[model samples]
Target chain A: MDEPEVEAMDEPEVEAMDEPEVEAPGAPGAPGAPGRGVRERRLHPVTPLRRAWAPVAVGAGWAVHDPDGAYRQVTDLALWTLLLAGGGLVVAAALYGFLSWWFTHFAVTDTELRIRTGLLFRRTAHIRLDRLQAVDVNQPLLARVAGVAKLKMDVIGTDSKDELAYLSEKDAAALRAELLARAAGFAPETAQDVGEAPVANLVHVPPRQLAVSLLLTGSTWVLLVAALAVPPVLWLTTHSPGLVIGTGLPLLGAAGASSVGKFVKEYDWRVGESPDGLRLDHGLLDKEHETVPPGRVQTVRIVEPLLWRRRGWVRVELDVAGSSNSVLVPVAPRELAVEVIARILPGVTVPEAEALSRPPERSKWCVPVWWRGHGLAVTDAVFATRHGLLGRTLALVPHAKVQSVRLTQGPWERRNGVADVHVETGANTTVAARLRDAAEAELLLQAQADRSRTGRRTARPDRWMAQ
Target chain B: MTQQPGDRYGTEGSAAAADAPPGETASPEPVWRSLPRSMLTLRRLLLVVWMVPLAVAAGLLLGLLAGPAWAAFAALPLALLLWGWPLLGRNWRSWRYAERADDLLIQRGVLWREETIVPYGRMQLVEVESGPLQRKFGLASLQLHTAAAATDATIPGLDPREAERLRDRLTELGEARSAGL
Candidate 1:
């Protein structure tokens, strides 16, 4: 196709598979690619003007906190302060220019999406239009108002490297459209992270579900339990029933505050699929909205903090192509989570595993295991028996990516001959556990790595191109 | 576990390039070959970050001697140096891409030695990043995306023009290779 010729002239992106190279699909994108568009002009981008204020605000905040002795001397006190203020402004302006310059020029030709950034260290990268796996569009309140969006690209042959960062919403949409046109097999080995979008269901967790989402995770539970006990404790301290009762009322107030905080954090949580792949957006503090295509997923991890086990809730995530590259959905019903994951990786099996019984509600430490642990222990590590919060996690490292096996000995653990053996299962970022029997753990890590590799081997389709 | 007949996912050469005339390398370009290195610019820029704190402290101390009036002002070059050092260092440190027959070789890192090998057959896409400094240098860094690590396997430095050229070469190679497969 004509587009393939263009893709031929674009930069190659995706994973390193030892397959015979073939004519990759055209850049128009396969049917299910994300947003699609093409740049038609050589124009300077229109950058949002408000970004200059952020650093200024930050500078002001720091100045407030630093009144103590941060700026005592005046090589030119007023000038330096002004410079700090001005520095923020200059950075803001420069960045706006940078962003605008970037937004305007960043284009996806017939073959690749291009970016030219920086004045000194000029750099450019092209994602083969055909290899585009998923396009994730994120819009913050300000970005939305500004009519700009952040696009995260996931593609075949590419690991979880952060995709091009910012773009105008219109451009992002077009880019997605263009990408969707070419989202076919660019990599022979990995499964494309494509999913049937979840049917919109009205029965989603309501305001109450938001409360429930947080009831276990947020600090509200501890606050509630604390509130109930405070009355008697206050009474004992005051030797006055009335004073204790008054104190008890305040405890209840604290509980309400805690509940509100949690609700806000889980506000508008969603787990769904866009044409490209899984899209998830949640959290209040450092908000995160991300997407992952099936093919890019390297491994899967299912986590159930000990307390959550009672409700059969689990967290899901995939190490897409490397460490630091991941797609996570914070909570899912155990069964639904399994089903969702199974669809992405038909070969992977959840295997009827049961949660650990009577796990401590709050332990000092929570350890993540190499295998889904199946309620097994690798090593016992503690800053002391009294340290660490209690939690449980299950990590899945796809067999295709196994790096190294190691057992660790920390300064604290040295006194104990026990070592934390780590089974690193993935190409870039590997999951590790502290196995007490260092030698045994090493053997196990190697063995498990081998087993995972074997598992991956079994998942490959011999008739890969038939479809 | 009973292995199904088609369950064998992939063979040994799953993501690496398997077919190529043994040792052919990509042709080199003359226009955008080497990185621009000017020590004076490097020193002036890096001196900002390196010297900022000291300048600020000195500004404070000077305020004590010459008074706060001169303290903060004295630290300007210092601040710029302190902030600019690593920037220049990183720019200086990065290696550009050289298209190879079987793989893309990316050499980059400030202190740590990192060389990423991206086999063409395994390549997903190529990306070019141009930060603030890049524009000034008229340089661009071509990233060779491989399935290895999202951010790990990348070749960072190149002339913007050369980067575009190389991107084209790899994409064509990838297309040709992919089609053959």
Candidate 2:
């Protein structure tokens, strides 16, 4: 572990030394060394692919103007006529791409990250440095080939609001690190030169596992099977194979397409650790790069499908502040998932599997199916609720993240002397410990209420800049 | 909104409100205050004066267009209005709010009861608003906004002066005890 940590720290510094940086005077990091205006400096130029593809797209559009065959028209066209029209269209598109690339620029001020873009309707958006949440660097398949990346910055109270696209990969990585460090309140001079550090890889999924997981992770294949079955069933009754094939084949194709899409979106999934934050990269065509700070994660869930239960494989999902819900570890052995959880949440102790037994025997009447699986474990820092027999799910929510706790008893539950306790964390996640003894529910509610009080008292303030 | 910034309703007001039946503990719990009585009368008038007449006119128009039998539709609104008159009073009676040391408590509902406790420290903003009907009745509402999007706890049917005072008190306490996540 120490070796990995050291290697991770060295990776970025080594990479930064290789890249040549255009030093702008009076940059945000180099405070007081001011004479020149850093704000006027533009970002790295966008890749020429934008200009290269514009003409090809326009020409393709012209060629495919008619859905039916228009090859006769193409062949009959004069060579000079084709050159004049195609050349004009290509030049026009290339000019537009060039102008767009030239006009867009971003600047870093002490207080804010200013982005100026748009051609006709010029827009200048500034995000306060104090409110900066995370800086993501993404490289699509096309941009990867061109060695360019896009940087997306999320602010505390805003959504995906600002981005600098088509930057050299080195610049993108440097900017991402600098912004993140600045957000964390590290001084400008020391933190600014974080360009070269490479993230240390913690988990890498092999191709076989990725494929198997993709196939079993979602229920899209069920749709494919259902669609295929529909045609055969219809054939027995209507005997109109034509109509059945027409509708079912399209449905089958759509299901297949969606499954393939999910595979593409999650291809080459990787998780790594950097000095600034945890880095996650995925997607084959349109990539997504996300940085989750140490304290930004609110809740984590460990899910084990029925098929995976026998193998002791669990999926670790996390909720971060600025990005969508993501799986930190798609499918890992239970011990590995727990180890990763311990790493992510340092103080929270997850008990061994043997200790996480079923709820009290008195509440057996409330739970009929696989009653042995229901359980709840509470620690000073976190609480875990385990339920679901077929597809078991163990949800862990830090005490500080819990907004409220509810204890509910329906008519049947009241009769059986059982109640359910639900803990909510903002909008994204909730953990419910179901079918517990009514007395236990009351105790749990009170304990959780106390936990929330202590958690709030000790928790870090939401705005670090305010401190 | 003109607000008098002070603890104007001192111990005397809380003591008076705390005069509840024995067996319930005091001191730890703040005395709950009910909405102004005028609010109930205003609601009854709005239903009887505005809603019922509109329904009756619609019923009459339907009768003219369709048949005399359709005019009987007017009775449905009349019956509903009569049934809802006491419900409105009961709802007003059920609405109560208490200003606690650490949090504000709101309790409402006749059947499915709900009690919400909004921590003063968690408050992001405090707003006082009134519509035409509420203004006509000299009543306003105090809304407490927090980071949680679902928390819409607004204490309605307060006197405009009282509403402003409560808003100021909440704002002061919110700033003084600022613990946020």
Candidate 3:
């Protein structure tokens, strides 16, 4: 498999790029070749191995069920059943896979990527180039072995995700690069320039740091401390070894396993600067490469656990348009988290006291749980909400992304002369530093609501070229 | 109507007092429009007509299968008719919607009050639908779907003509506001 050396693209140009011209299948001049006059006509084919294996694997499972003689099945009879049933299933699956592969066709046009599949009930899904959000290339163990990869495109304003499964590894990479380049509105010659764009490695979570971060995050440390305190207390009170072992061992085991799970899931976490927005690549078994375009992120949360607060470590998480929650920085120093926030969202950052805006001190008494942990800072482009005692969170939501603003006063909050202001974005909503002064919350709600409307009205299409 | 002494805002069981501060609560009491008064009667009748047969069949099946001990569930229909009648009326009475310049507020619930404000600009799709029963009564529901899944708001039991007007107005506003995106 060959990796295509392609450059990053400009955001606005990506949006401005019109629907590309569809090439006839088998044209000589392919997308990769700049000077060739022949239109690229070859539609990449998908590997049929996945579909071939599906039914065979199910049949094999059935054949293997109750293999032990204790289950009253003769070994010879079972083997015969396995051979007949598994063989039949394999043949059936192979035919199905071949038919599917024969019928499925994918084409990358100037403006859109079209994928047509289904032997009888034909379905064709087209993904517009300008609306392309991310191009993910997936290679499972089998696909990698077969030298094939799957290309998935996430487009804006559509539910039908476009997938071109089982392309040759080289072709997949080329297609991904080509699509990204096209989205960025790059001509063939200029596309090479994007490849040279400096990729700033913001922070790479090391094994040691990841372990420390996991330990300090959420209830892992608390559970450990409690586990330590529990045996002593249980031993003194119950004087029963059975109960102690029954409860203590499982708790410790569960906690240890969970810590490892979290570490493994986020193994080799890396954050880097891409052409459009920021790219996050992580995971151990199934590697995930996510490209979060600018303005796609509706809400950004910076969390600092109780222990991590002292160490000045925080986790930066983002909620994009389609996805629920994604971690920008799983765990990093506060400075790095803040730096990432400022970089990703230029106009919005952790409010540092200076000439422009000071942290809201008037609403300090509203948050009774932990006043010090709660703060609200508003800027022209975004509003930042800071809250949490155990795990401190700093949520930065752009005014343009805000769908609505709500000022809620419950019986308890009203009694305390405090209220909560909620700012809702596309997918997620962030409360204004928890409970704030009722009067101030109301004012903030109105101001933020107006800001949201104004921001949407005046927001630029793309900030890349504008900046 | 003067508000109850214990209330902060004009909530359930609390009379709507004339005077209130600007920032203390939402402004101007949001000239609220309640659901059709007949919706309560329609809902109550539907509940009784639907539940009586269902409850009797379930009770009979249980009596035949696992003895009469389980047949006690049949009392559910009678209980529903007795309490559900008033509960439906209260719920129908509580359902109120107010349209502001920028946002639409829908308030419902008797004990646990819930107020949802769906900004007109944020609305992606507006649908006016009527079920068979509702259509028979010339009533329709106006559903507003926003980007946020949780923000999907529905106003039920509006006149069909009114629903159509609201839908057109909302769709127009949504398209106008979303043009910038």
On lDDT, the leading prediction is: 2
Q: Alpha-carbon error at A270 in model 3, in Å?
A: 2.1
- Please give the lDDT score for candidate 2: 0.68
Query: In candidate 3 chain A, where is summed lDDT lowest over 10 consecutive residues?
Result: A1-10
| Top-down TM-score ranking | 2, 3, 1
lDDT of 3 at A75: 48
Q: How many steric overlaps are in each model, in order? A: 136, 7, 15
What candidate 1 gets wrong by more than 4 Å, as runs, is: A1-46, A58-104, A109-111, A119-121, A127-134, A154-170, A180-207, A218-265, A273-275, A282-289, A321-327, A354-390, A405-421, A427-429, A432-467, B1-181
Which lDDT tens digits does candidate 3 get at residues A105-184?
66555556766667667676666665555656666666766777776776545443356776887777667766666566
Model 1 Cα shift for residue A423 (angstroms): 3.3
TM of each candidate vs. truth? 0.47, 0.76, 0.71
The fnat score for candidate 1 comes to 0.04
Q: Which residue pairs in candidate 2 have backbone atoms (N, alpha carbon, C) closer than 3 angstroms, thus clashing? A: A11-A197, A11-A198, A12-A196, A12-A197, A12-A198, A15-A196, A16-A196
What DockQ, on C-alphas, does every prediction get? Answer: 0.04, 0.09, 0.13
How high is the CA lDDT of each candidate model? 0.49, 0.68, 0.66
TM-score of the B chain in each candidate versus the native B chain: 0.56, 0.81, 0.73
lDDT of 1 by residue, A245-273 (tens): 77777778888866775455556666665
Of candidate 1 chain A, the 10-residue stretch with the lowest lDDT total is A379-388
